[model samples]
Target: MSEETVRSAKGRMGSFSFEGESAEGLLRIGEVTKSTGLTARTLRYWEEIGLISPIDHIENRERRYSGKVLERIDVIRRLQEVLGLSLAEVKAVLEQEDRLLEVVSRYRKDLDSGTRLVMLTEAKRANDEIVKRLDDRLSEIGRFRMERVERGQRIDSAIEQILREAND
Candidate 1:
């Protein structure tokens, strides 16, 4: 893809030209699905659930996603599949992360030590919540793994018994 910087009305560097199209690193639905291994219906459902959104392209009315949205999609996928978090849990974690970002931004702006302390405390609270959820999921996975291992051992013992009987 060709790269060209385009500035927004606010004089901020926003979009890049991809294939002669001046969109904000915007990609078509098909391209996103192909790259992310997600279906179009899944993307739509995510959008409906306030998880992710497509940019408004009034020209063709087609759904386009920016590069940042693509990264967010990856994050959502990892939270769900890797961390074994439900969609609701993922949403909660995402919201907490956003809150943490807000707190950090405010902390940067305010020079007062007391106010900074409050912001840091809030950030810690949000981080703790996220860590707690992850810990819970990890515990569940551990239990599941132990159960499977025990079952495998029992199966192996039964097979050994059957072999011994056949030899006798």
Candidate 2:
């Protein structure tokens, strides 16, 4: 893959390149790597984590990505590199985006006419959903931490009893 610099307003350097014939829309992992500068492993890992999914697979089970998935990969890159999100955070964002898509589908008619009420309602719902997800994640992590602390305490108790018995 070859890249040429893209000049922007802030004079920051960005690169763009074309994958031969493959940028025609649907792309394999290698083509995506060539065009987006993401590795095949990263793509597979994203898929494994449910962040992005390929559109189809070929005979030998090679992944094929759609245009939408490519856009998702772009968003994932921005979330990780620019926003400094961990994989868990990025997963939450992706899940929220998925919910937004569902909300958009449900309110397709309102969105078509650019209705403000429907838009605000859907946005609020999306925000609430994200909050709920984050709260649940925090609770889950807390529970795991508590379990580990309890185990450590049990170990310390056993060690203390052993030392006391030996002394007695």
Candidate 3:
């Protein structure tokens, strides 16, 4: 059986359904680019850097992606443009989120308290890591704003001093 077939089998087992997306249901690379308003090269580059992966259409060797992948692309855009994260930082955040999702999935099935506690702890750690990265970025922005404000004040003071000297 193909990987897609195996993924479909797993999907029926209640796992995340990323792998089993049918070709007919999948969007071609051009369609994805049009839907997301991203260029083809950008999508390919993101895939190259491990930020995103489009499913391969085995017959024609074309790239395809699911709706969930489109949602993930939106998240990636927000992380980069809104959160001011570098690609590396965005990747880190995505990894932590993926880990948290896995932990949540396993926690739902495992009835043992000890195992649940461990999973909970891991989830917390992943959440904290994401928070830390955001906090660090925010702090950097705050410092930059302060520096710009201070420079503007200094420039204003110099201009005022020059006016006084000229008037005297």
Candidate 4:
């Protein structure tokens, strides 16, 4: 198998780890930037904005990030790209990340135990039902409008014929 496939399999098996990849339980700023696919300047800017902070500093005085920082980066990316949250909103959410992760973890545990149904499935069903209803309503409205237009045309024809007879 390819190296990437082998790594994926190892990761799935929980044997592969990202620990110590960083500098002394903290990743170097460059490593974080590379791992996250974000630019170094962006990471620094985020730090300046108080959106993310490094966990430690090395002897060389370089910033280092912890595992939590990696998680935060992922959250930031998701909030911006998937949820369409603005930078300010993403920052606000990051402030509440711990609580959100706790809640999500509880729900995930419940789902794994089959105790709580996945809300996503229910939401999709409800959305499909609403779309079907809207389509039906639109079709009904179109048919009603067409009937009214036809009736008005018939009335106009009758009025024209009546006027013609009166004149004759």
Score every model by TM-score. Answer: 0.77, 0.54, 0.82, 0.44
> What is residue 122's positional error in candidate 3, in angstroms?
0.5
Error of 4 at 154 (Å): 28
As for TM-score, the candidate ahead, 2 or 3, is 3
Instruction: Give per-residue CA lDDT, model 3, range 25-74, as digits (tens).
Output: 46667667767789999998888888888765465666767656777898
Q: List the residue pairs that clash in candidate 2.
A: none
Q: Tens digit of lDDT per residue, candidate 4, span 27-46?
A: 56766676678998999899
lDDT of 3 at 69: 75
Q: Evaluated with TM-score, which candidate comes out highest?
A: 3
- The clash count for each model shown is 0, 0, 0, 0
Model 2 misplaced stretches (Cα beyond 4 Å): 1-24, 109-122, 128-168
TM-score, model 1 to reference: 0.77
In candidate 1, list every pair of residues with a backbone clash: none
* Candidate lDDT values, in order: 0.79, 0.68, 0.81, 0.64
Q: Give the local distance difference test score of model 1.
A: 0.79
- In model 4, the number of clashes is 0
Top candidate, metric lDDT: 3
Q: State the lDDT of candidate 2 residue by residue for 1-168, as single tens digits.
A: 222211121132123213332323455677667778888998888788889877665468667665567678778887778556689888887878787877766676554555756776887788787777657667877898899999999999999999999999
Please identify which of the two predictions, 1 or 2, would achieve the higher lDDT against the true structure.
1
lDDT of 2 at 104: 67
Model 1 ranges off by over 4 Å: 1-23, 28-31, 55-60
How much is 153 displaced in model 2, in angstroms? 41
Local accuracy of candidate 1 as per-residue lDDT tens digits, 90-147: 8998889889989999999999999999999999999999899889999999999999
